[model samples]
Target: KTEKTYELQLLNSEIIIDGKLNDLGWVDVEELSDFMSINYGLKQIPSKKTKVKIACDNKNIYVGVKLFDDSKKITFKSGSYDDFIDTFDLNSDYFIIEIDSDHDHQTSYAFAVNSSNVKSDYLVYDDDLIDDNWNAEWISEVFVDSSGWSIEYEIPIDIFRYSKGGSLTWGLNLIRYIKRHNEYMAWVVLPEEKVGIVSQYGHLKNVNFQQKKTFNIKPYFAYDNEEYEDQYYPYLLDENNGDISGLDFSGGQDTYSLSQSNNKIGFDINYHPNSFSVLDLTYKPDFGQINQDASEVNNTAYETYYEEKRSFFIENSLFFTNSSHNNILFL
Candidate 1:
């Protein structure tokens, strides 16, 4: 089958991202439908219907999606912000937007949002190699009605690094998941035997590109203060009265107060050195706010694996690793 293509148009007016597709700018835009199911390498009609539309402006690209289903049967869980309901549960409906900013078809960005309005984003390298720790800031609103549910996204143009040109064509793909039927549908049906998912994406044509200076800096500050008290023996202390030379503290003990404090300030700089590449710099890197990994107890003779969450190291890890499949060095 030939690859599908869609011509993106400019929005006539502003669109408020209220999760409703009632904007006048989207009136003349065409909708992409007739999604096909790719379950077990079989192409068939899904139980529900799905449609997507794309439009753009000078500063942002707008996406509107409608997922038709029974309002009551929609599965979702409510939790804290960025809880990512889709990844944690097996029975949840969600939408995924994959965009190849550079149109290289080798790497892409995957943005996902569930019915609960929670969002999660990640980077895809070599089609299927996913770096789930990657995060981006974007706006999305979700609305649920009796007929079905819909979502709207406003992605900033500055988030991606694309080639310089008057007009550009990017790769785009949309995916929808239905939990009730355990069905998966895609606008561009990816065959199971396909070598790469991103390579099979449809084209998003006529993207007006204007090269502007892209530079961003994020500053983070962290403070930690710890206070505690400990008991020690006077006889065990040396000349410093605080040093113990591997002595057993089983004799009379005296209490002493101890306290420690630390402060860290760091900045993450992102600058587009050219139209096709981005330069990232970190000064005194600080990633204390990132989530901690779950504690695991190992019984067998196997090495423990830990995911890299540092922004500086994982920003452009593909280039650092020379596109290695193992991804053991930089990911």
Candidate 2:
């Protein structure tokens, strides 16, 4: 590593922009595609043009994406991928972001929203055979800035762990509306047949600064409404298909799934221990809808991008991180 001093902390939501907000200086679909096409020599097909703006403070990264001409009248599809989706279920536009903290390309993070307003967070582990079972709270806000319509997201550094003020590269990919048009564009483009998460992304350089550490512990005290069912049914062996079983979710009193958003009753703690060495403790576990797999050590390419904050350890009420790493004598 070279010897240098760079401002590493995004301490507050205060972003230092070099100049004024120039919507004209924006990257459109074609311009972005052409840049990617020429550089990667990939015959990039075109997609719908969605205007986006980005800025960051010490505490949060401010992203303003303009989803133009969204046909609010149409009833878009609300579920997973299917053939011949009904006319009422085609959303005109949505958004996705592939974030790679450093240049290591083993796997990266993928988050998106569909035109029907459905939200999902998936892992681009093997970009080609992309599976969709990752759960992350795609929590964000949008308001009319003086410039244009903007989406403001407060993404926590603890959500994706890295040292304070540390810097790394990222990848960007955005899918569009108008499914008949079938458009998807990238910041750094790739091939036409390059379909899933792995093949599409281009690089975004230098973005991270752990200005502060905030573990938002909001344990809601509320009453359960749904009919709680605790039934351990027989597992099906047939290969036909399955549904989002209400049985799996229902509980004894009002069962909770160790989820932050849906289950808001328990004293769910978000621990922010002083030492970053507690890194071994923090884990972002798989969701309840589907507990896929959780044995991988290296998440993304960047040595600075892996932060596992799984809720299982918290809800179970036993913390192995401090107990194991510190060799604490707990009687």
Candidate 3:
């Protein structure tokens, strides 16, 4: 028989949310029953009246959660590692978090973010664990949510142990209580399934550090025009063909290209904490172009590829040119 290993830990800073994150004010992790609310779209069902909380000390990490379900229905599913490209399907609600820069091949940004704010994690499943290699000792305090529902969990710090040892910026995300009608949105943005691997969901920007560091700041801008031959301009993509064709045949006219141009500005600040460490990008614009792939590249590297043709990183991307929307994902 053969053996396998894993890593998922590193050094990093705290996450503080002072203002209202979304329109709703911050909900305390203690009295969760008062927070859960009923949402209409899905099934006119209310949120679970549960509490989700996690506390961590230097030596260990702890997570505490409370779950409230009136239906008393709970089910979980896990998948094997070798099931993508060769075997890919979005048959479940999965959210992932991967951390690199601390350990080695045993662990990586395979399922989440590193200590840096680079969005290069591809995960599967929300709320549930990804593999059997790791185990989470979870306990739930349930309740009936005529108003709504909720749950709580406790995760130990030993849950992760990576290769490279240094301060890191870990990514966080959650996905749960999703069905045909009702879907719980991701803490991180989840793009459409048809977009497949081409999306940006669950982005944890600017996770700080407390180790050797190199901070650099840069700001710039540019402008361009568009031309369309087809009066009915459409996005570029081939749901029919599995090949990637450029902007030529997607339904635009190079002749009708917008001869007009505009001007704008942007900035970037990155820190290289250690050799092989990544750059931080929490403050970077959601539409800023990225730095290009170096003439030399590393095998276990992570990066973000946006749809907008940024002046910075416009090449080496697997983007969907047809869909007319800003659909990004976590992976």
Index of the highest-lDDT prediction: 1
Give the alpha carbon lDDT tens digit for every residue of 1-331 in model 2: 1111112222233432212223332332112223211223443544333555554555455444554443433224555422122322245344565664433453555556554444555555544433233344535543333332333344444444333444665555544444544444445544544555554455554575544544555343433344444535433343455643333323334433442334433433455553132322222233332334435577786764332334534321223432333665444
Q: Model 3, 173: alpha-carbon shift in Å?
A: 1.5
Per residue, candidate 3 scores C-alpha lDDT tens digits across 256-320 of: 33455666666666556643454444333535354443254546556544233342231112222
RMSD of each: 5.0, 16.3, 22.6
| Model 3 ranges off by over 4 Å | 1-53, 64-148, 163-167, 178-184, 193-331
In order of listing, the candidates' clash counts read: 0, 22, 69
- Candidates 1 and 3 compared: the better one by lDDT is 1
lDDT of 1 by residue, 225-253 (tens): 99999987665557676777665567668
In TM-score terms, candidate 1 sits at 0.83
Q: Which candidate, 1 or 2, has the higher lDDT?
A: 1
Local lDDT at 218 for model 1:
76
The full ranking of all candidates by lDDT, starting with the best, is: 1, 2, 3
lDDT of 2 at 115: 49
